[model samples]
Target: MDCREAREKLLLATSDDLPSAEASELRSHLTSCAACRGEEARLADVFGRLATMKRDRMPESVRAGYWEGLSARLREEGLVRSPGGARSVARPARGISARLAGATVAAAVLVGAFLVGWFAGLFTQQEKGTEPPRAVRPDTPPPAPRADEGREREPIESAPATGWTSDFALGNGPADRGEGVYAEFVLGPEAAGENPVEYGIDEALPQDPWVASIDF
Candidate 1:
């Protein structure tokens, strides 16, 4: 047998479970291969040491009591396989349930603490009232005007009556009447005729009777 096959059979051999043919093959390989023999010897020594160290030498009475207790426990847990199996029951795994329970409790506590801290942070942020800062844009050139630039405004023929007006001769002046036509009218002594009227007369009838006038 090759070294790999021999090593596999060697493990089964240590368990006293190797078939007779395989056992013989492994023994034959060990006789010719010094390296395989040395490996087997090392494994055997390690297994022997472990076996010697791990087992606690118990008195016959104590051993019997332990077996009885294990059998009763197995019966209670509904794990007793057969009537004869109780005498040679496997040892219960060491502290597995206690370890698992402790780990579960620790994990729960850690999760609860993390959740509390997370919510506390949220509450703190709410209390402080944090808001994202407004973004500042970089300076850029002003936009150009649309193509239909000066066409928006239609020129007014005259100033608004209630606002202000400008005569052809006078530059810019306030309107005489609050609401009146913005046409030019002759207003000198000659234009007023022989019975000339002053500018601020309250009842100054126009010399031209048909001309449009204001009451005030």
Candidate 2:
């Protein structure tokens, strides 16, 4: 396999989860590829160091108290017995077990509460719409063309003009008959060809223009 493929498989190999055949193939590739082998070694070293780091240990006092509490609870619950036919008082060993169980349950409850609160906070923030600004990658592809592509460009036969006409003021002065204003107008056939129209001035329009009014 190539270096890229071999490097990807190296993780499975290090974890000893790679199938025998795949592992064998990767191993063979690694033997021949120094760069891939070096990368594998570096990853193995990092994981080994992480694994060797000491985990958080329960304090001796905390452990002792836990056991003591557990024993008392067990005795109260009638789970442990005393010697000499008399119901034995809660012992250290019993207390230790009980305390450990209690601590475990408490920890689980705390974790569950924390997770619930965190998710709730996240949802609340989402409802408020405080979203992190996305970094638009330069290489992202544009949206796909719509299914009705080129449909708008199809031509429609124009109807013959009717006799009805009306005059309207064009700005404050007489219209510049031959100035050649590149106006874009949408005329509905039912409006006697006097549809909503937009006139572009000599200057370019702003990026975000205000809408004054729209008539149906």
Candidate-wise lDDT, in order:
0.33, 0.34
After superposition of all CA atoms, the RMSD between model 1 and the true structure is 55.0
**Model 1, 106-177: lDDT tens per residue?**
111222122222222323332344421222333322223433333211112222332211111101111232
Candidate 2: Cα lDDT at 25: 92
Candidate 1 yields a Cα-based lDDT of: 0.33
What TM-score does candidate 2 reach? 0.26
lDDT of 2 at 134: 23
Model 2, span 1-216: residue lDDT tens? 876567546656776777999999998988987766765775565345333332233333323343344335435555345433343332223332233332322222222122222222323342354532222323212323543333212112222362211111111111232111111111112243333121111111111111011000
Q: Residue pairs in steric clash, candidate 2? A: 66-99, 67-95, 67-96, 70-98, 70-99, 71-94, 71-95, 82-88
Tell me each candidate's RMSD, in Å, in order.
Answer: 55.0, 35.9
Residue 10 Cα positional deviation in candidate 2, in Å, after optimal superposition? 0.8
Q: Let me know the TM-score candidate 1 reaches against the reference structure.
A: 0.26
- Badly placed stretches (over 4 Å) of model 2 are 56-216
